[model samples]
Target: IHRQAHLVEGFSEPFRRAVEREIRRLGVEIWAGCQVKAFGPEHVWLSDGTELIAQTRLWAGGFQVPSWLSTCGLPTGPTGALLVDKYLRVQGSEHILAVGDCADFVWGSRLLPKIGVYAVRQGPIAAQNLLRLIRGQPLIPYRPQATVFVCVTVGNRVAVAEKGRLVWRGYSATVLKNFFDWLYMRKLKPLRWQEFFY
Candidate 1:
């Protein structure tokens, strides 16, 4: 279920359609442009006075900034994310950097969506920029990628992925998803003396 008209609103129309197809194929209902008024252990009540049996209900809420950030007197975006400059530094403040969901990282005229891809890309640059700031060296400005990869595993072993004009589905997309998931999970593995280079 999604409150938005499109489940993946900012994504390409084809990507969104592909994902929706996979989800529907899995026998899961799509409740777009709707809201759940309340949910009990075995049932869910919708805002339109409809109740449905829901054995397992999953609710994914939107992100919210900490209340204390408002008290800090820093400039914030419409969603209350701290405004950040190109260098990922908090606007008007040096030695303070904000990224990911907590930051309103703007590119051109719009703020980048709060997604993991942007956060992962911004992380190393933010680290290097922070170091450069301390050493009085030039801080590197973060450039949002022209085409970021997006993948979603809908259900079973199926998935959908997109990058630029490229779109993928089913087995190929699932393989790509697994490969990226492996790379991400690799970082969580502990280092050993023999594998220090990893």
Candidate 2:
């Protein structure tokens, strides 16, 4: 169930539509603008007043930022994530940087989405900026990707993928997803990013 009007808000229109279509095709019911209001031993109730039966259920509660951020004196947005400048530096603080889900980074007109892909991409830039700061060099600003590539696994060897205007579904997409996952995990080549801290 999703509280938003669309399954994946903030994403491109075509991508969101394709993802919803593909997942629905997998026999999964997509419930937008609703939430589980309550649950019982044999039934579950939704905010929309719909009752569902038969029982294994999963709840994916939203994120909550760290409590310490509130009293730390650094500025934070409504979500409690530390507000950051384009360079990812915490507002009103020097020599401190935040990235990933913990930061409220404004990219273009809106806040950058807090997701794994953005976090992974931010890591190197954060490290590089830190090193540059130590060396008394100018920090480089993070540049978000224009086109996003995403692959979602619906069920049983099937997946859906999106890259800008392109979309793919089924087993072939799953294979592509698996290959990318394996490539990211391959140990033969490490990014050697640890050196940035040293």
Estimate TM-scores for all models: 0.85, 0.82
- lDDT of candidate 2 at residue 4, scale 0 to 100: 76
Which parts of model 1 have CA positions greater than 4 angstroms off?
62-67, 187-198
Query: What lDDT tens digits, residue by residue, belong to model 1 across residues 1-198?
Result: 677787876677899999999899999789888789999989999887889998987767766688777789888876688999999988999889988888998788777877788998899999999889889999999999998888888876688999999888887777776777667767878534333211
Candidate 2 all-Cα RMSD: 5.8
The candidate maximizing lDDT is: 1
Report, for every candidate in turn, its global Cα lDDT versus the true structure.
Answer: 0.83, 0.80
TM-score of 2: 0.82
Cα error, candidate 1, residue 178 (Å): 1.5
lDDT of 2 by residue, 1-198 (tens): 787788776666776787788788878888889978989988988899999894788777766688998898889986789998877889887699999988988877877767667888888899998998899899999988987778777777778888778987888887877776656655446654333211
Question: How does model 2 fare in lDDT?
Answer: 0.80
In candidate 2, the residue pairs with backbone N, CA or C atoms under 3 Å apart (3 or more residues apart, or in different chains) clash, namely: none
Clashing pairs in 1: none
Whole-structure CA lDDT of model 1: 0.83
lDDT of 2 at 174: 79
